[model samples]
Target: MRALDLTLVLTNMPTTTTLRLSFSPSPPRPLSNRACPHGPVISQLDFFAFLNRHGSFLTPLSCCSLEVDRRRRSPITMLSYDSTSNVLANQFQVRELNDETDFETILSADGRFSVCGFGSLLSERSARSTFPDLVNFRFARLNGFRRVFAHVTPVFLERGIARPETKEISGLSVEPCEGESLTVTVFEIEKSEIPAYFEREIEYRFLAVLPQTLDGKPFDNPAVLCACYSDEEFLRVRCKGSKEMFFQLYGQYNIDKIWQDDILPCRAYLRHCVLAAKKLGDEVYDNFLDHTFLGDRKTTIRQHLATKGSGIMEEEPPESLKIRYGG
Candidate 1:
């Protein structure tokens, strides 16, 4: 996987068009399928149209440019990395690419990191196969999303797996679902089951499962990467021995937004938890308004009466979760 510094990335890039950022704390604008008056909205159909013409989704770095084009008509860059990973897997090495390149940066440099790695079968399956097993062995714990800030932008949910596999290693499969924004509950401290100051510890949890799936069972070895920021520093934390190690300084941003804001920090912490869980290969626990459970490759659990068999779902009551969580 390739990573870059945000400061150098922003400074080295040349600005082209004027960009405007709007943050509305009010209820989110209802999603519409219609075209926007300002410009045509890019949808899955538009994304696939570009794929049909180009043979592959736009490169991650290239997405930044497409996003900045104010008068894009039938513009051809992809926004999401879902399809891009497999399409570019052997063809591309992220580490070899320069920091200034990416699809999202080209779209809107001002785009806030709303979770990207959600809502797909292929991406979820890749995450399932590549991540590690959580100590609790739950499926909901297996997945999560991250906040990515990109100046450039492209189509969301880009295409990747034009094909599917036929294997069942553990009879597990992550089903497809719609997107939802939720808070993070899990925390990866310097050590697990040990107490520490909240500042020294990292808090996070999963966001949503992209509508993608894998054929084989979840993989035993999954690598997770974490980006952490406090008022003092920003760093990447790599998972190792049940705990993630922090390294590779990613530079810093004014926490003024983070500290002055309430929901942003909470959301960031939740995103961190999910990102770590994805690396760890643990199933994420989805907290629907009324219930929660451990999801596996094949099943969604509702009761303790029946076990999902992946050992991913726990047959525990909701009260148990409340007690363990103290919420």
Candidate 2:
């Protein structure tokens, strides 16, 4: 059999009479050495690099340094060996490391840290060329949608980071679906240090994968409800409750105005949604519209492009009266 080499630092000198050795079948055996008394000794297992003809294998023992204070000497020792192998599959194993070694690697993956990191990256100017082409969409509006409008709120709508970040947005992201639908996961990278009443700001990140393409191109006039304020009509979402509800309510409210011909200012609405979504956590939820837009976004955009008056004013003719100077 192959021997594994291991060394231990002795605080209390171990004469041959006091020395002892133990072995566990799981790790094979450590090479024994009593040949040297003045220096470090090598074990037989350390001599050969064991080759794996097929399955996976673990190093015979745990490698760690042993500290000796008496003689001011520190030596290395092996503790345990663990491995996993499958006859027809690849082998895998998880080695348990010391607490100090493992924690340093995992700290960055914690929830709060992720939120803050994303928030920092988002605060900078966003690039706009990444989105798809649209007939009437302005680059500026697209930029707003990507960075501010569609983004999540810093405060989690569900209270904690355990729930997806998407819960905080307009509140329309997550819901039960029967047919083709979307699943969105949202996370807040950072909650702003400032209190809500003071500035009410947050930064967030969100992601959604949908089975069907939103295909905004097909809708006669698709519009993003964008944002809203603290009002009962907008789903009664308090800072403590579901922010997703707020987004849903805001969308419905906008649609109400569209049907009533009391069209709200699109830019203002978008800006509000952007800021509101940020404050809720850092991330917010949104999805493709299921129903028709109460108002036709395409029609509105066309009107803006034409820049012409409609109805009676369009039909009216200019008067023949001419201005006279110095008559």
Candidate 3:
């Protein structure tokens, strides 16, 4: 009776540690399971270990559990509030979560807006910690977009997610894709608070998007949020002229490095993001697995989780940045 989030994820578990990719704009290192000279290169083993530990894989939590429990299959995805009515009942439909996109509507009301969240902000705990007064904290989906962990950030380092000893660090971002959607959180903040949010999300592009409710209906208005994509030209457009001014206001540096750099997701932050998705319920968790990807744009979080889910989530963030910066 749980709704399958975004039904997507295609990954092949690599047997070795060294990355052998055949793509031009590849990540600077291995997608994951990077071969460290000091350690054994074991990836798939971690996945099986997770299965063994959990006994029967639970729905939404396990990797690709939508097709699980062949003996007890059921119809009807979940019980969420109706997009239009904000009421829940048997007629509550999963179909509404996957709405068809109308580009014209999205473009019409992008400017005067509030904020949306796809990454850490998806966590109400993290959201409230950052924006104490955020209101209308609700779920929405941004169509024609997919979330990925492609861009680099020092925040990971400061959070101790990225230690100096590990493979370089990367964070999450959203990019344009056809026939794709992600469950994101949207909230309203005072106009006076925009500067603080901008600074917190310095290395990102403020994307204007039309967000929809669980039942395939658009919000009365559009929203703008830092999508953390790596398109400089697009950043210029979204920056409202002079990306430099935008950066200065946000107190960000290394603009070129943030985009052009290659790094992998820190286990700690990756675990945090995946756990955040998990908190949104089974559907949102599955949606995250299906859409979220490593920097390569080829590796799925499901693929990674399937093999090393236990270790990654259990692994501790490095003391590199925390010790250096005192976070």
* Error of model 3, residue 92, in angstroms: 27
Q: How close is candidate 2 to the true structure, as a TM-score?
A: 0.19
Per-prediction count of colliding residue pairs? 63, 31, 4
Q: Candidate 2: misplaced stretches above 4 Å?
A: 1-188, 192-232, 239-261, 264-303, 308-327
Candidate 2 or 1, higher lDDT = 1
RMSD, one per candidate, in order? 21.8, 24.7, 17.3
Worst 10 residues of 2 by lDDT: 139-148
Order of models, best TM-score first: 3, 2, 1
Order candidates by lDDT, high to low.
3, 1, 2
lDDT of 1 by residue, 244-308 (tens): 12221111211122111111111111222333434434333333211222221112222311432
What C-alpha lDDT do the candidate models reach, one value each?
0.23, 0.22, 0.54
Worst lDDT 10-window in candidate 1: 150-159
| Regions of candidate 3 where Cα sits further than 4 Å from its true position | 1-113, 228-256, 260-262, 308-310, 316-327
TM-score of 3: 0.56
Candidate 3: deviation at residue 111, Å? 13
